[model samples]
Target: MSSNTTQMSIVCISEMKNSKRVAVEEEIIGMVKLNPFLYERKHEMYKNKCMRNKKFNELGKKLNVPAQQLKARWRTLKDKFFQEFKAELIPSGSADEAVKSKWKWMERLRFLENIYTPVDNSPCSSLNISKTVQELQQNMTSLVDRAKIIAEPSVPKSAAQLFFESLAKQTEEAELTPAEFCNLQIEILKALKAASIPNYLQMFCLQQI
Candidate 1:
């Protein structure tokens, strides 16, 4: 029947795509082995923008995939591997058999298990946090003014919504590295989640007079 044939075709297509992803990931990991700078975190020599771009271009030509797409795919694969196991390395034994079996890319992307960047304890980091708070406070001040102006309780936006919109706008407009952008997103979510209760209280109290 057509229904059974269609299901079979879908499975075949899924398998083909998964196989292609595996090939691409393997190619990337092999290249990283040859060029450690591609994944090294603290190496000054590996931080050369020119060399990095050249390597990525080389890879793009060889794989017939855009460099940015390759980078994004690698990010996704790394996320899967890390989510499976929180350790610095994947277990080779049978303990994580379920994880290894469920996520086929686990062994292939195990090299990324230790890519955790340590927290920066420098004064500049402190200043950056202070600046972020200042910018957020400024945004909230404007939103707060709007809230005060709204006479009806049902009309004003919640503080969390305002905060998310402002922060997301900043994120979208800024030219940030992928890692920095990801960290900012995490911070944004955490701040919004923590403020949820207070946000409701603030909205409930809005123009209660």
Candidate 2:
């Protein structure tokens, strides 16, 4: 074949491949829209299968592709199909507003699931505000304990004296009450004395003070 004819043939073949890919993609999307549950179940299966196969690096080497690239493409296709299926679940506006609102909340939950850690591994698994608050309180307590260790050994006499003196001057300027002034002095003592304490506890107490 002549050079120009060969080039034309190659272009035609490439165009045909592109057209075929587009058609297949559209068909998959249509199937997902028509039967969301089917698609979702299939997607879940694929996700489980992918996770079970831990030797992705070896597989990629055999396939002559980067493992990261293969995994990324797989994830993209999986997410695309999943989203298409979810979109199908949205009812028409004519439906009851309450039903629609419920569906909207469900969709939000799905979105959050995709973005956040899975329930099994999540830090906030219980999804209870009070539980989360309790966890935070525990963490704060631990931090305080660590800080106390770090802050041990009182501040040098000279530093404590200087800090108190400075505080007294400030208290006078601000016209603070005795009680408030005493609190201020306590804070100063903690800050100056904390360095002698252990690293972990010093930070915790200093922060609270």
Question: Superposing all C-alpha atoms, what RMSD in Å does each candidate have to the true structure?
Answer: 13.0, 20.5
Clashing pairs in 1: none
RMSD of 1: 13.0
Candidate 1 deviant stretches above 4 angstroms: 1-16, 87-101, 117-209
TM-score, cand. 2 vs. native: 0.25
Q: After superposition, which runs of candidate 2 have C-alpha atoms over 4 Å from their true positions?
A: 1-54, 93-125, 129-209
> Given candidate 1, what's the lDDT at residue 60?
76
Q: What local distance difference test score does each model get?
A: 0.51, 0.37
Q: Compared with the true structure, what per-residue lDDT tens digits does model 2 show for residues 153-205?
A: 57443433333344345445666433333333333323333333343343333
Relative to the unseen true structure, what is the C-alpha lDDT of residue 205 in candidate 2, on a scale of 0 to 100? 34
**Model 1 lDDT tens row, 86-183:** 42222234452223445666676566544543245322234223245345444444454445434456766666455545544554566555544444
